[model samples]
Target chain A: MPEIRVVNFSKHFGKVRAVDNVSFDVKDGEFVALLGPSGCGKTTTLLTLAGIYKPTSGEIYFDDQLMNNVPPKYRNISMVFQNYALYPHMTVFENIAFPLKAKKMSKEEIEKKVLEVTKKLMIDKLLDRKPMQISGGQQQRVALARALVKEPAVLLFDEPLSNLDAKLRMMMRAEIKKLQSDLGITSVYVTHDQAEAMTMASRIAVFSMGKLVQYGTPDEIYNEPKNMFVAAFIGNPPMNFMENFKVQSKDGELFATRGDIMVKLPPKAKEVKFEKTEGLVLGFRPEHCKIAKKEVENSIPANVYVLEPLGRDLIVNLKVKGVGGESELIKIFAEPGMNFEIEEKVYIIPDPEKLHLFDPETEETIL
Target chain B: MAELRLNFFQRNSSKISQAVMIIILVLITSPILLGYAWLILRSFSVDMVHGFIPTKLTLKNWRFLWQEMKGYPNIWRTFLNTFWIALWVMILEALITSMGGYALSRYDFPGRTSMLRFILVLHAFPSISLMVAIYYVLKVIGLLDNLWGIILLKASLEIPWGTWVMKGFYDGIPWELEWAGLVDGYGRFEVWRKIVIPLVKPGIAVTAIFAFLSGWSEFVFINTFIFSQNAWTLSKYVKGIIGDFRFADYGLLTAVGLFYVIPTIVFFFFVNKYMIKLTIGGVKG
Candidate 1:
């Protein structure tokens, strides 16, 4: 295993920059994910790492060797595409043996390595079946088998689970994570699914547009996002953002105020140096807010709009009156057995420690 | 089955249209069917008592099958020449177009779109208009009156269309497959040979069929440039039988024409599925 370093790498397609200047490092045996939405350049970064695309600027290094001018075959990397990309004309055995054959390895060696990898992936019985003859999940496992049989220095995956059904995707996610740990191969995974990144990656580099927005561990990215984009993109229900706020200190406690709504900042905010205070935005997760029947300190008044029951948790959709001259919708996760009625007035009290403040102009985290 | 389907007019109108369609189809196809019947009958009959009716049956008209016709070279020699030309043209066109189409489909370069459009325009210019220029070029190369000259010319003329059809097939393949090959440790050319070419087999089949048929039936180029009698193909041989309209042997002409077309029919039957796939591919693509 070798450490992979991408320094100020950029890839441009004609006049359009598919991947802007970005830098990151993957320590030996580390599983790093480039996470972003569509057209966010996550896949472009992975392809360039695989030597499929040349970087417009900057350098990539495997350990201490420069890989800028290396062709794909010489780069010693294997990729699993989103579509599996198994050769339709080839059986599973041949597809897995392709990389070995390319190296001119002896027939016996190719067969042994292919069988070992296929058995490991639990797709050995399908060795004689063409790609189309198997189910999508089986095809996926075969693709993984082919990629692993090469035993390359680095493994790149471009949303390998995106084509699978949700239940199968969850299963494969665990399988891939376990395999990476067992093999200890340095890997780069690209995905637009935030949960996939948060659950599987040792570290994640979040991308937006064509630039690397933030790089951190899953815990850091979820608990302390660097910017508003990272905060909004990482969560499932998404972080609720309320703009047009005025942050002011009252009785030595920081409070964010909008029209008739006010929220108390967390106690830890006292240590954060505020660059600006007038124009700020308040952010909090739905799970972080609790519904109260009566008004409480640092709570906003709202009327119940709708309720959605999800087995264990109930999502209460509330409408705050006159937050910014229009009723604003808010959501809070409550116990499924709780009694709630439409148009019933309530108060939304957020956990003080989980509150976030951002500057409106830069959209960067302030506290 | 449900019986409460349609109103009276709807059912009656459908029946009327079906009847009308049958009549129209019968009217349109009967002439072609009768013409083919007469061609087969004329090839086997020696004399006709009533108009368009065979009166005597004989195999003399098909003597070209066993011996050369008067004033013509051995029939087998001409057949072999045609076979060689067709085989060579099929090989050349398929080889050139498959490679050319892959290039047009995959590579990105300056004027790529313009070049594709230019190919279409080149194909649009009827080959008949370029006969003079082709003749001069063949003369300059000292290949005039040669079978190879006609083979090369026929392959070149069919290339633009063959290349375009092949390009369509190549475009349907996912780019991810090639990327996977490259990442799996194959160079560009190796990936093309091993991965891409196998996938475009139907496209090559379609191109080869058209090229072979064109070369087998070639007469204008051979007649104009190929002055030597030994180089004549089946198409030229058939033309020679009908050269003297007043005293032409219609029976021998029909027999030779049928012989020339039997291989084409057999070849079509062998690869009929590929032609159907091409149509479906065109529609889907």
Candidate 2:
């Protein structure tokens, strides 16, 4: 296994910056994923790491050795492309044996390793079948097996599970995570799918518009986002933001207010020194916003706009009357048994400890 | 009943249009087909000097050709010369075009776009226009009347078009396959040989067939450059019979033409699938 460190790497396709001064480190045996939307440069970063595209600037190091000038073949890496890219002319056995053959291993040894990998992937029965003859899931397994059979220093995946169907993608995600853990090989997977990154990666590097937005553990990224972008990006339904919120200290008590809908600020808010801006954006996840029957001390009155049942939970969209002229809509996760009619008046009390406050101008978290 | 009658009439009119289309196709194709058939028939007729519709039929022409082969070795010499030239051209064309095409498809070198544009522009220049210049150049280089001269000229002439065709075929193959091979410890050339070349076999086959035919049937260059009878190709040999007014052996000429077409017909039969694949996958797709 090799520890890969990308140091100030940047790739420019003409004027378009595909990867912009991105740097990260993958510890030996670590499974890291580069996650972002399409055109967010995650795949480009992975391709650069694989040495498919030479960086426009900066250096990459494998362990202590500089690798910017090294060719891909000399880098001792294996890559599984998004399309699987199995040789259409070769059978599964041949595809898996290709790397070993390239290394000039004995035929008997190649066959033994091929059989071992195919068995581990449960694709031994498909050894003789071409890529087109196999199912998508089987093809994915073959791709993984081919990459693993080489026993390279680092394994790179470019959205390897993006082409599979949803159910199969889930299964393969778990399988890939398990495989990485079992082999203890350094792997870097690139995907636009947040759930895939959350489920499969030991650490996720979130990218946006060719910039590394955040790099942290899934739990840290989800629960304690550093910026408004991370807060909006990490959650499935996304976080709701209310602008022009003010924090005031009145009668030795802390309260955050937007018009008349004011709630007592958590103890942590007192520690933050607010800037001169009058408007602060209050952020809360859908799950943290609770629906209550009666107005409590910190509850805000809202009218239910739409009720969406999501099997075990309900997403209730509520429009709250604001201090400003217009009303703002927010989603609250309700219990499965809870039922509310459209346009019905209700009150919502956000969990203060879970509330995220951001500077409206910069969109960076205030606390 | 009236509606059903109208529907039947429409269906019959459609069938008649289809027949008319087939008749038009035949009308366009029959001249070439009939010409080939007449040549084959005349080759075997005893009185082919008059016309292809000979009153008497015999294998006199065939027997005379066989007799001449034994004494002069003309037929064998010409056949060997043409085959040798075509073989060299085929090998050179496939190797040069495949490598050039692969480079053009994969690499991002300086001046690549201008080079590709230059090649495309070169393709637009008719080969006939270059015949005189090529002949003079070959003579200056002491290659006149030499088999290698013709082979070299033919292979060079075929490269631009062949490279264009194969480059398009290479473009259709995903770069990821080569990338996978590269990351798996194969160098660029090894990736091309083991991954890229195998994927574009149909393109190479197409280039080979076209190159072979171009070299095989070329008359203007072969007839102009070759002065000696020994260095004469099949086309030059065939032209000789047509040139002599005193003994214009039409039957022998026809027989030789038929013999020459046999290889081409066999070649097309084997590579027709690849040709279709090239047009379908390389061009339209």
**Which stretches of model 2 miss by more than 4 angstroms?**
A320-329, B1-6, B9-21, B46-53, B69-73, B244-247, B283-285
For model 1, residues A338-367, the per-residue Cα lDDT tens digits are: 799899999999998999988878989998
The sequence of per-residue lDDT tens digits that candidate 2 reaches over residues A1-367 is: 8899999999999999998999999999999989888999988888888887888998899999988878898888889888998998888899999999988999999999999988999999998888989998898899999999989889999999888998998888888899889889999999888888889888999898999988999998888888898888887788988878788887876788866778777888778888843688889999887788777878889999998888887899999876546889898898667889889899888898898889877778886
True contacts kept of each: 0.90, 0.85
Alpha carbon lDDT of residue B209, candidate 2? 89
- For model 2, residues B92-119, the per-residue Cα lDDT tens digits are 9999999999889888999999989999
Residue A173's lDDT in candidate 2 = 85
DockQ of each: 0.69, 0.58
Best by TM-score: 1
TM-score of each model, in listed order = 0.96, 0.93
Root mean square deviation (Cα) for candidate 1? 2.3
- Could you give me the TM-score of model 1 versus the true structure? 0.96
